[model samples]
Target: MNSPVALFQELVQAGPPADAAVHFDTACVLGGSIAGLLAARVLSDRARRVVIIEPDDLPVDPGPRTGVPQDRQVHTLLPAGHQWLERWVPGITKDAQDRGASLVGPDQALTAVNGVPLAADGEDHHLLAIGRPLLETLIRQHITSIPNVSVLKARASGLQYRDDEVSAVRYVTTTRADGDEQVLQADFVVDAMGRSSRLSHWLGDAGYDVPRLERLEAPINYASARFDRPETTAELKISGVLELFTPDYPSHGVSVAAANAIEGQQWLVMLMGYGDNRPGRTMEEFRSACAQLPEIFAEVTAGAVRGGVVTYHQAESRRRHFSGLSRFPARLVSMGDAVASFNPVYGQGMSSAALHASCLAAYLGSDADLDQAAHAFFDLQQVVVDAAWAISAGGDTARLDAESGAQVPEDIRQQRWAMNQITAATVLDADIARAFNYVTFMLRHPATLADPDLLARAVTVNEAARVTR
Candidate 1:
């Protein structure tokens, strides 16, 4: 060991060696969204410099941005994501909540599934809901606190590599000082570029067989509009919602009272559908979707000032088999939408991405084994994501919709039994609801429902109901 001054001398004389070797001292993270930011934070801690390349000039305040379409829609940080935020960057939630973000206490935002009411003490958990822009802006504020981090207004073009090692992150930027082409040379580069990422193509061109992406696209349409908060205790709607998404009715919708959720004030409304039954972005079409609902949702929405409907259309859940890649570079990784993007109807993106961040931290913390770490990280991700897909998609397959082609005989039987069990259980059992919370919050897997006590009760309920009806 040497003193700080002597260490510098020894390092220079001995070619700057360390107890542990370093691949690169800097990383260029592509994309500046939630996942991109999370990946950048991790890279910042390990590298000497971190640059976040975001094509869209993001908002400096708590408002909508042109880049992220879903910003205006309802978004909430799941408890799992919240936990990671507390760990990765303290006071993030506190700072946002201090503004106008409303906190939905553990059990206050009650849910009724398949007609069963869930009861809870609401003691140990809480999920704070804030507008997407506010949440990201608050986080971006935290990012500025880190000296090594800087955001570049640029559009990433491609990746350049030398012998499988990424050399520079190629990009085109007009907003920087003189508006010229630029290259961010670094030891590592991360693709947090989200759903429209071109990372795979860039990697393919470098002679690496990119991951085989698994896509289960079924067209889904969403229309969302923001309204001023309602102003009346009598007119106020406190809880969120859940609806039909089965073979008989292949889609469901939800409405949330988001930031500035005060009595007699404005709130945001989002109406969505699966397959060909998707919702429309037009104010007229949006009203029609709401009218289809029983009451309150559309009625209240109709009376409020409506922001023009915004639409998001995508029909598949895609996951790249990156861990299965035979050849990959060290210090290179993909997280969030770059790796996989789930059907947002499930609201698992942020939570699952947080789980993925822990994977990133864990991978970096352990001994240097990039490939092993990648495989292990994604393997864990597969469990969480696949479980959610099964619950959401399997439920979709049960709906009797025009576009949801008939299921195979075996699949039919399985869907029937599974749907009956889950729907009935969710509506009736608090424990089942808790199990669902576990899955939703990323604290446990869906198979956690297989617990003896919970599963036995569910089976008993299923069998007794079958006998009675």
Candidate 2:
């Protein structure tokens, strides 16, 4: 088995070797979300025909869709995700910029954790803060434009199997009677239906052993509101700002606050809270929350409000370990939230989905057995899922502790203490910040933080800072 760090490095590479020949005939991707769209893009290269089944009538122009409730929120495409988008669809960042998305380098983005701002590490880490709607639209357009790819507006009902392998998809079209079902022949099928995906139940209903579902209860409530940007503030150096508060570092009642200069000359601001300390939906309450955050948040919110505050709540973070299953259907795989859905506050949904697409590309590009389970694809995807899960669930687990007033487990206390020290050291040390950012950006694995020398240095730096204070 490949080490997690090595696997992550391989997955992050620009593209699956370009010489991999087409091997699939027909591929069906359910759900037209980022995951499904990216999957279609990857399959388009390997399959003779690829069909994306999305229930919503995707708009020609960039706008919010009913399928994605959190579309209006400030969506930041981390450097890793930006790289994958460009790798799959060349010049996609430029395409988004042309459509009014904002791209910012390290100099133009501000990141502070627990009231301590990280010093610039002199590294070139650029991110695109394209609101989710616009980013999804661009990917949808690019994928649908492919000669071999087409989209169907329908709801997938179930899967059809032959010789223990998925062979077709049964779906109901919006134009037909609600109970009427039609079957589409497919050599391969992908489930990208998101966190609410029913692929597990479908498998169990068909007598296949379903992978264990893991859940970490995270009672998180978040609200996002848009504000008009002032023309005079064009001189402002920063286009994006993020302040994160952990259980170790509580900021009033707020968990996180982020502001981004999005398209339409507006500043999109989001405030998040946990448990009982929920953000209010009213504009006044939203502004009050912003006032509690960094001064940048207040300055941005000083302008006219663009729309009402949009609020969303997530109950838990979930993951299905398909790789752990002993038996599974062939020619069928699940991606995106169907496999794992982490806390949205980490902004890992879309980026993780993009990485999953990379795994699919690598799996299909290889000459593999189609009559058996897709363990190779599941293994590659597990690394991507676990990387995101650790960052997201780790923080939420701490919050759960705070909520219950429970003590940290004795076995994990040392690890937690080490991480806390590292987090504190990020503000004082530039190199540590770069390493930390690399992991958080999903470009590297979390194991990189376990370097003994790095941990020792973090402790020493934090001790010195405390002595100085």
Candidate 3:
């Protein structure tokens, strides 16, 4: 087995494998989510036929769809996520731009601490803030265009096994009122139903040991509202802005807020708060919160509010330890939020899903045993899950009260202090900023921050910054 860092590097560096190796005769994906769509794209490369089981009546033109209440919230494509998107769906960024999404380069992106923007390092990394609706629509279009992939408007009910191997899937169509379920024969099956996935229950009901679930209580509430962007945005040299308040000085009880120049010539600004600091849903409350944030938030929210404030809440971050389980069936795997769902404030959902697709591609393209459980794929996926989980949950754990019944290890507490130092030093040093950005963008693992030289520099820079202050 390769080291986690080595595997991560391989996942990001490799593109879709050659289509010469066909692995499965028929594969069924449970949901038509971005994760599922991407998985279908990968399966189309290896499977002769791929069928997506989705319950929603998704429109040809993707405005807002049912079952996705969070579509109205602002979503981000980290630079690493953008790389995977381009690797999977070639020219997708350009397609989004043609359709009105903003393509923000490192120079055009802004990250501020306590209202002070970090200095630009002029790196080659770039990101797309296309918002969830447009991004999903474009990916869905590309996935549907593949000749071997088809989508079935149905809800997955259960699985059928033949001699302990997944042979088919059971689902009920959306138009059916008789409550009749149909079986679709699948040589392979993927569960991408997201956080609400019932794969565990299904497996337990069938006498299979289910993966143990782990959760961290993170009562996060955030609200987003769209507004008309200023025509002079280009002149301002900022296409994306993330204004963050450290724990020491949260602005008006708001921990973080962001403004992204999304498609439709508008800015999607979001305000987030933990536990008791819920953002208001009314327009008046939204504007009040923005006014208390940085100047950019005020300037962007100054425009006429285009829609009502959209709010979303997540009580905890969860992960299912599938690799730890030994009694799993062959020809079956789960990805995306089905395996692990993290805090959305970190913007890792889509990108992590894309990487999970990369893991699927790697597994299918490899010479692994097809008659056994997908432990190899799970190993590769664990690296990605651990990386994302650490970034999102690690921070949330620190913010919660000590009486919340959560225990923090001494080593983890020490590491968090070091990370805080490095983050604070980003505003003062460019080299450190680049390295920090690489980790935050999901381009590099969090372990890189622990390098002795980097930590020494961060300490030095932070001490000097304190003196200046």
Q: All models: lDDT?
A: 0.64, 0.87, 0.87
Of the pair 1 and 3, which is ahead by lDDT? Answer: 3
lDDT tens per residue, model 3, 143-229: 999999999999999999877789999999989999799999999999999999999999999888899899998888989999988
lDDT of 1 at 457: 78
- Alpha-carbon runs more than 4 Å astray in model 3: 401-408
lDDT of 2: 0.87
The per-residue C-alpha lDDT of model 3 at residue 353 equals 91
Model 1, position 55: C-alpha lDDT score = 86
* TM-score of every model versus the real structure: 0.83, 0.97, 0.97
List runs of model 2 lying over 4 Å from the truth: 14-16, 246-250
Candidate 2 lDDT, tens digit per residue, 320-437?
Answer: 9999577788999999988999888888888898889989988887677977889999999999998999899987786577667888777777777888888888888988898899
Model 1 over residues 1-469: C-alpha lDDT tens digits? 3332232222112211123233347778888888888777766677788899898877676677766777776676776777777677778877876876656665345443322345452346657667778888888888756898889889898877766667788888946676566788877777888877898898788777788887775566766676665445324445343343333332234221112241124455666666565565678777776665545455447555656877777778787877667776555778787777777766768766766666665556556565332565555445545655665555555554324466568856754565466556665556666676666555555555546676667777767767987
Question: Global CA lDDT of candidate 1, please?
Answer: 0.64
